[model samples]
Target: MSSVELREGLVVVAKGIVCVVTKFTSLDNISVISQKEGKRFIVPFDEIEFFPAVTDEGVALIAPELDELARNASDDEITLAESRFDVIGRYSCGEISLAEALVTLEMSRSNFYRLKKNYSEEIGMLSLLRYNRGNSKGALKLTDVVERYIQESIDEVYSGSSASISKVWSDVEAKCISSGNPLPSMTAVRKRIKMRDEKELYKKKHGADAASQKHDARPGKKIFSRPLERVQMDHTLVDVILVDNVRRQPLGRPWLTVIIDQYTRVILGYYLSLHSPSAVSVSSAIYHAALPKFSFLQKLGVDVERYPYYGVPEIIHMDNAKEFRSKKFESACIRNKIKPEWRPIGKKHYGGHVERLIGTFMTGKVHFLPGTTFSNVVKRRGHNSDKASALTFKEFTKWFVKEVCIYHGRKHSELGCSPGSKWAEYFGAGGDAPMHPPIVSNPFKFKLDFMPEVTRSVSPQGIEFKKCFYWDAALRLHVGKAAVMIKYDPFSLGTIWAYLDGEYLPVHFSDVTKSDFSLEEYHAQKMQGRGEGHTPAGGLEDRSLAEYVHENKELVKRSQSETRRARKAEAARSEYLSSQREESNEIDVPVDKTDKADRPNYSRRATPFKGKNYD
Candidate 1:
């Protein structure tokens, strides 16, 4: 259920008419004004259907720290808080009408509404506590001008090692004298400096690394007992070199993005590509993680009947990488009810789980592969990772899938049993606390929700994106109209999905015969000045694209360039080459088509992390 409280300023559908709540008459009765008709009337709470909030798309607003705010409240403050809670409770529960509750509390209607608003928005009872007795203890009481001068001095003069507290005090005293204000005592200046956050102060005084070493020490272990309760996601460049599909020449290492469930220590999902990790990588990994893997494994030619670990994680713990911090990534998480958490700026230990998992894969499995970089220069002294390379990307992907399955079965040092066994304890048939994990019903739509979104206006010819033109018959109706949203897959740019009306309408390239290629290949072409000309209004022909690929392949075979760009280009072209035969004309959405009879009828379980004791 959504956490938004039905209160004033919330928009809802009341008896099929869109209305905005004007005021709350009582728990059952809300006075609302119709958005269309501008008519004010009382709407029964049951008849109103709430949707996403006006802002933040449906993300629940996090309330303030109520316990800390109410801790130092006085006796009178406590009494008023209790009374306010009583009145709001009575009004909301319908035990007493709005008028009776208001009169009993001896408050005006406006104040009553205000109190209720505070209580609702503040996440219940403690919000009613009054904390405005006076300036808080230990808080600075310097005059505004004096305080500003002191802060400016500290920031400008004392932030460096050359300036001391005495120097800052002297600067502040000079400013006060010039402004005809009372000079602050040295003790006050010292107190202000002392109150500054240690890490930030150290960073300003020295540098980021010093501050990080002084602070951000490892904390206690993060314990999670349920699968998908807290997942850690991270990216690493795989240690082994990969070869191209066509010429078998060595390509560079590919970046692997892995998502691991913290409690079970099982690999939930991963995405591998030659391009560095970006928003696409993060989104693709998340899409793979939140949906079942049966069809995914089959596509990779792994014959696994059951890979029961798939669901939206309650919290995704990730490092403060640019990809994880992108607006598109955060918006997607919020839209899907997934929370994205960033570890402290300099704290590497916060991401230990995913980091250690990557280390284990590199040391235990990848180190033995042909053309392995062996993790560091010291380890790779006598080895030739490029000459020894043999595995192609497709073969490596298959190996990765099999390795993940094997890893799941291996007994974990901390769990005292295999991760697969731990997963089965909660979700397997006839096991302790057997429960069904949440699944995305429409996997295609779920994946689409995370694809990077773009908005463009329709033109007479079609929509142009990244120097390519896409058109569909459905776009004719809205040609040259208001801009509409579209999403494209980085792996394949043959078709882009246009969000028109309500559904996603597939928009194909203007040149219908052109084959699909990745975004990396497109950029590579542009970088070589081969993508300079205006694409024919009809779109670049398949013949030209094929010629470019042929040239790139010849270049790779002759030069065997180990540069990142050449490797990325080969990786992109190889994906197209390997999948040309198997690529489905229809979208590969992996929608669940399992027979109801074959699917297990496991009982649904509420998220286990909720209300769990943290202490």
Candidate 2:
């Protein structure tokens, strides 16, 4: 090898980014970056734009077409990757960052940077052109849509923002409108809006449904039956984070759900989430609670299979919510072999046990950050934020063991004595060693994703959904194909890949695939069509229930169902009106026969406790 001493001169431009090529013994790759605290990127020789000019010291590099890269490269693609690499390199190689190297090489960071970036990324340049061209034609609306899509990609970066998707969309529209821009077509605008709305709806619906699923997962419907017989769980939303150091403003309350022994209230499991009260986090808390308490479980008369809840609760209680009634929830209960017992709607007494515990958090030591609503109060109380920084979810769990099993171990202040002593005294939980061992998470392992049978049908072209068929062009080869299994990534809400006959295709839905945009609306229209005729198309001859029953049993049954449905519809309308009335007394509430039927139920629940009888 020739005698060539390598000096870090003006880091030369390679590809479109700034890079430095060391002329020392055969170097294979070069890392380039920007100096800004949060803005940096790296590109190998192939990716970076390099200048033909080479200084005596080494090759000089500049971030050519920096604007294009800034526009097209994702924050993670550039900023995060660069920062992470630099940090890692500092630890491992102690290599100076690209910006620093540039400073030392060319004596001017910006000047050397300009030289390296002689070439622009054509792809990024094209994207810029695409965005700018839309300016004359509802471009801002399109920009708003793109922004939303991009925002989701980096949502974690702005997780603190309270701006909802709808709010953001509205803000975009207003800003454009204020500038006298013509709005995008309403249909197109709605197409843009529905994407996020669908996920939100799905998330809410699933969360509600998951609660019952948790019940189904209980080792027993009632934990007291014969040791680990059942577990009862409920989530509480609380206000916390008195001072959000990140935002320098108050944060919304956190939600925490605990899965406890329906029999022991032993605090078997719990989870705290930044989101509001939800089933997903509730399940997580329960999962964390369940997996670890196993060794202690055998002591309580439980095993692995026997662990999932069995024998339904004798009297389970919760405020009426969709989570309690969802089909999935019911199925979970059925699967776990437990009968679900739901508290009467709005009945506070029925839920008093769980409610009172939650209440303690509200008035007890749990601190409520300002702006905390009643919902927030409950969350802050259950969150176990005192140990929020625990390295692992399981470690944070130690806080519950300390709080519920330790500090509160005394003569049930609430239990009348300490839970441990109370357990020995009342439930007869004495002398039995915990069944399995205290459950611990396998830090080396992660949860296997839940795999559910997604009801689907396949044909020549692709899969069919809601009476519509969708198959990407690449899949056309497999048209009239057999059933294909698709796994979805929850975080991205996108298809991870598809499997056809056990072969992974890595295929995702493409633009050509028509989405179920009007699924809910179409179903509503179908239901409306079914509701058109009751007595008769033109005559009242069948109006009498007896006549209808005699002529057509089906008609009679349908009429009865229609009657019930009509009553429900009327009640819902009345309830909505009543809510509006509360907001503004001048608004007249709707009159409904169902309201009369419902008022009694509400009044009964709200009735000052007359002792606790459903009847």
Evaluated with TM-score, which candidate comes out highest?
Answer: 1
Structural similarity to truth (TM-score) of each candidate: 0.48, 0.30
Winner by lDDT: 1
Clashing pairs in 1: none
| Per-residue C-alpha lDDT of model 2 across residues 1-615, encoded as one tens digit per residue | 122332443233444443344333335444444322232344443454433333456532223343334434453454443443343344335476766655444446564444334323322221121122233433345555445543443232212235344444455466556665544444554444455444443434344343343332334222244324545567776533322322223333445676555454555555555455544453344345535444434433444332322122333344566655667555554544445667644334545456666666655534432333334445556554433421222222233334454433545454565545433444333466443333324411211122222435455646654344445556766665455665432222224345665554544434445432322223333333334352334555455666655679877888999999999999999999999868876667676657565555644446465677878
For 8-50, candidate 1 gives per-residue lDDT tens digits of 6665667765557889888679988765456788878788766
Q: What 10-residue stretch in candidate 2 is worst by lDDT?
A: 443-452
In model 2, the runs with Cα more than 4 Å from the true position are 1-231, 242-249, 293-317, 368-408, 423-615
The regions of model 1 sitting more than 4 angstroms off are 1-219, 429-432, 455-471, 478-484, 490-495, 508-615
What Cα-based lDDT does every candidate model obtain? Answer: 0.79, 0.44
lDDT of 1 at 56: 46
lDDT of 2 at 512: 46
Candidate 2 local distance difference test against the native: 0.44
